[model samples]
Target: MMASCVFSRWKIPYLASMYFRGVMRIPSKESFLCSRVMIPDIECSSSKTMWGFKQYHDGRPRGPLWRGKKLIGKEALFVVLGMKRFKDEEEKLQKFIKSHVLRLLKMDMIAVLTELERQEEVSLAVMMFKVMQKQDWYKPDVYLYKDLIISLARSKKMDEVMQLWESMRKENLFPDSQTYTEVIRGFLKYGSPADAMNIYEDMKNSPDPPEELPFRILLKGLLPFPLLRNKVKQDFEELFPDQNIYDPPEEIFGLR
Candidate 1:
C-alpha cells in the first residue's frame, strides 16, 4: 500500500513516519497583510520532539499610555485606584499623573476618581479632581462632584465640599437625589448638622422631589438633635405608610 499518504490540492505528500506520535503542520489560520502572528516552531531535543511558539513582536506597544520606557498598564491603574497604597496623598497624586492615568478616556477617568473615593483616598482624589476641573474639555458631571463631595465629607473637609456644591449650582447643574443623599451623609459625618439640614431643605425644594430613602436617611442622620428628627419622622411616616421606617435608637436621642 502507499501507507495512506495525505496530500494537499497540489499533490503534496506528507512525510510518513511509523513512529509519528501526533500530527504536525504549518499554522496558516491567522495571517494579516502587515501584522505579526503566532507561528509555531518545532523543538527537537535529544529525547523528545515538541512544538513551541515563537514570540510575536508587533513592532511596538499601542495606546495613549504605551511609550518607549514609560509604558503602564493594569498595575498602574491599580496604583491609581489606591489598590497599591502610597505613603501620602501627594505621592499617590504624583504617581497618578506620572503613570498617565489621566490619559485614559473621560468616562474611565471618572470611574477611577470614584474608585479613589471608595478607597478613601480623598486628598489625592480632590487634587486629581482639580486637575480635571482645569481641563478644557471637562463638562459638568453630577456623579463626579458627588463622589468628591462624599470623599471630602468623610475627611471632614466640609468647607471645600460646600464650595463644590455651590459651584455645581452656579454652573446650572443640579444635584440628583443620590447626590443630595451623599452630601447630607457627609455633612452628618463632619458634625455639621446645620449644613446638613440646609441641604435637606434644598433636597425638599428641588425641582424633582427626592425619594423616601433620602428623607429616611436624613431623618436617621438627625439623631443627635431630638427636634429635627421628630419633625422628619412624621413627614417620613406620612410619605411611606406601607414601607417600614427605621428610627435611630432611643439612646441616640438621649433617652435612657
Candidate 2:
C-alpha cells in the first residue's frame, strides 16, 4: 500500500505539468511565448521549502518580514517629526510613534518594541508606559521600569518619576539598589536632600541591600554637609567596622 501511494503521488505532478503544457499549446505562438511561464507545482513547492529552510537556518522565521521594516519606518517618522521643532507638531509625532509601538507590541513583536524603547524617544517612552499600564505588562520587578524611572528622572519630570515609583510600590515590586540610588540622586538634584536621605536610610536598613549600599548612601548623602560628613563616616565605621574609610588628610581641612 505504501509503495502504491508513493507511486501515485509521484505521477500526479507529472500529469498536472503535462496537462498545463497541453493547454498552453492551443494559444497563438506570440501569446504563448509572451505568457507567464508556468512552473511545475513540485518545483514551486521545492523552491518555497528551500527558501523557508534558508530563513530558518539564518535565525529568521518565514512568516513575516514586515516587523523589521515597520520598525525602520517608525524610526524614520520619529526623526522627521523631531526636525519640526514645533511643540504641537512634536506632540502629534510622539503620539504617532507611540501608537505604532503599541501596535507592534500587540502583534507580539517584542524585539522591535524593545528597539523603539532603546532609541530614548521620550514621547514614545511615555506612551509605552501608558500602554504597559493599560495592559498590565509593567511589572515592578522588571528592569524596564527602573530604566524608565531613570529616564523620566533625568528628563526632570519628577512628578512622573514619583508616580512610577508609587506604581512600582503599589505593585509590590521592591526597588533594587540601583533603582534606589537613581531615585536618591534624582531627589538630591531636585533639592529634596531629605527625601534622598530617607531613601538612603531605607536602603541601609534593607534585609539584603547591595554590599556597597551603606557606604554609597552615606557618602552621597553626607558629602555636601561638612559637619555631618565626618559623623556619617564614623557612623559607617561603627556599622561595618571592617570597611575602610577614604578620608582626606586633616591638613586639607586647614587644621595644620
Candidate 3:
C-alpha cells in the first residue's frame, strides 16, 4: 500500500506536467519547467489554460527602439558632417566637390578651383572627377576641363595638366577666359611668372578675355609677397586701357 501510494503521487505530477507542456506548446521540457518555476506571485494552472494566461501577462508595451531626438535627413546630415570635419573654407569647398552635393556645374567647378587654390590633392580630386564622369547628372563641359587643369597644375602635376589640356583641345572643347586665368594663376603660384605672363598675353588675344577678378587671382599669385602695388596699377592700365581703375564697391570687397 505504501509503494502504491508513492507510484500514484509520482504518476499524477508527471502526467500533469506533460499535459501542461502539450497545452502551452512550450516546445521543450526545460522551457516548460522554466515557465512554471519563473511564474511570479502567480498560481500554476493546467497546460491548456497557461497559454492564455501567459499571453495576458505579456501584453504590456515595451519601449521604442530609438527614443532620442529626431534624425536629420540625408542631405542635411551630409552637409553638417562635412562642415564639422573641415573648418577651412577651402577644405569645405573641396568637400563639396568630392561629395557632389552642388546643384550646378558652374558652382561645382568654381568650388573645385577655389579649393585647389588653397592646397592641391590631385589624386583625390581626380577620383572626384572620375565619380563625376560616371554620373549622368553632371555632364562634363569646358568648365570641368578647366577646373581639372587648374587642380592638376596646383598639385604640380604639369605633365598631366598639359595632357588634359591636349585632350580638351582634341575634344574641341575650346579653352575659355576662365581656363587661361586658371593656368596663369597656376604658373604664378609655382614661381613661373614668365609662363603666367605668357598665358595672360594669350588670353588677352582670345576672342573673349577674362575680366577683373580672375586677373586679380593671377596678380595675387605673381606678387604674393608684399604685393607690387605699382606693377598692379600698370597691369590694370594695360588690360583696361580705357576704363578707370578705382577701388570697387564695399559690397564687392565683401565688407558690407
Candidate 4:
C-alpha cells in the first residue's frame, strides 16, 4: 500500500510534465492564430505606417501633400495683371482685387504694383497704389509715389501725376530730380507750360540740390516763353556756372 501511494504521487507529476512539454512543442493552430492577432506584425500593422525608418501614427495628414498650389512670386504678380481685364467694370474689379490681390503678402503686392507700373498700366497701377495705401501695413513710402508718378508722367497722364504729387506732398514725401524732369517734360509735351513752370518753382523750393538736367529740360521747353526761359537760364547759371546754355538758332524757336 505504501509503494502504491508513492508511485501514484510520482506518476501524477511525471504525466503533468510530459503533457506540458508536448503542448509547448506543438502549439494548437487556433492559439497560434490568436497569438498572431494579439501581437501584430510591425511590417503589416494598420495602426502605424513607416515613413523611412520613422513610424507615423494614423492621424490627420499635413504639409504640402494636402495643400493646394501656393500663390507666390510671379504667380501673385500674374494675378494682379489679370485684374486689368476688368478695369472698366469697377464693381467686378474691386471684387477681383478683394478675392485675389488682398491676400498677397507685402512684398508680393509691391512686386505686382511695380510690374503694373513697368507695364505702363497707369490706371490699374494707380488703383493698386490706393489699395496698398489702405492696407494696415501701409507706410508713407516716397519711392512708391515716385514710381507711380514717373509712370503717370511717362504715359502723359499729367493730371493724375499732379494728383499723386499732391498726395505725396500731403505725406511730406518730396520727389527727386528725375521726377521733376519727367513731370516738366510731360507738361511741356502736353502743352501745359503753366503747370511745367509750377513744377519748376516747386523744384526750386526743394531741399535737395538742384540737378542741371531738369534745368536743361525746362530751358528747352520754355523756349516759347522767353521770360520763363530767361528766368530758368538765370537760375541755371547761378547753380552751375561751369555749364554753357545751348542757344539754339532763333528759327528753332520761330522767334526770327
Candidate lDDT scores, in order, read 0.66, 0.58, 0.57, 0.81
Clashing residue pair totals per candidate (backbone < 3 A): 0, 0, 1, 0
Give residue 205's lDDT in candidate 3 (0 to 100).
58
**Which numbered prediction scores highest in TM-score against the true structure?**
4
What are the per-residue Cα lDDT tens digits for candidate 1 across 16-63?
A: 432243445333323341225333342212123345344443444464
Structural similarity to truth (TM-score) of each candidate = 0.55, 0.52, 0.37, 0.70
By TM-score, the better pick of 1 and 2 is 1
lDDT of 3 by residue, 25-105 (tens): 643443455475775544333333444443232223343212211333334334333533554576665667556444435
Show model 1 residue runs off by greater than 4 Å.
Answer: 1-115, 241-252
The regions of model 4 sitting more than 4 angstroms off are: 1-75
Give per-residue CA lDDT, model 2, range 1-256, as digits (tens): 9999999999999999877864443444333433455633212221123322411122233433344555555544443334233335767756654565455443343333344455555445655556656664544444767777877767667778877777776776666777777777777678776666666666665666455664566565556665656665766777778877775665665535
Which sequence of candidate numbers ranks them by lDDT, best first?
4, 1, 2, 3
Indicate the residue-level lDDT of 153 in model 2: 69
State each model's C-alpha RMSD to the native: 9.6, 12.0, 21.0, 19.5
Clashes, model 4: 0
lDDT score, candidate 3, position 82: 54
- Return the number of clashes found in candidate 3: 1
lDDT of 2 at 190: 84
Q: How close is candidate 3 to the true structure, as a TM-score?
A: 0.37
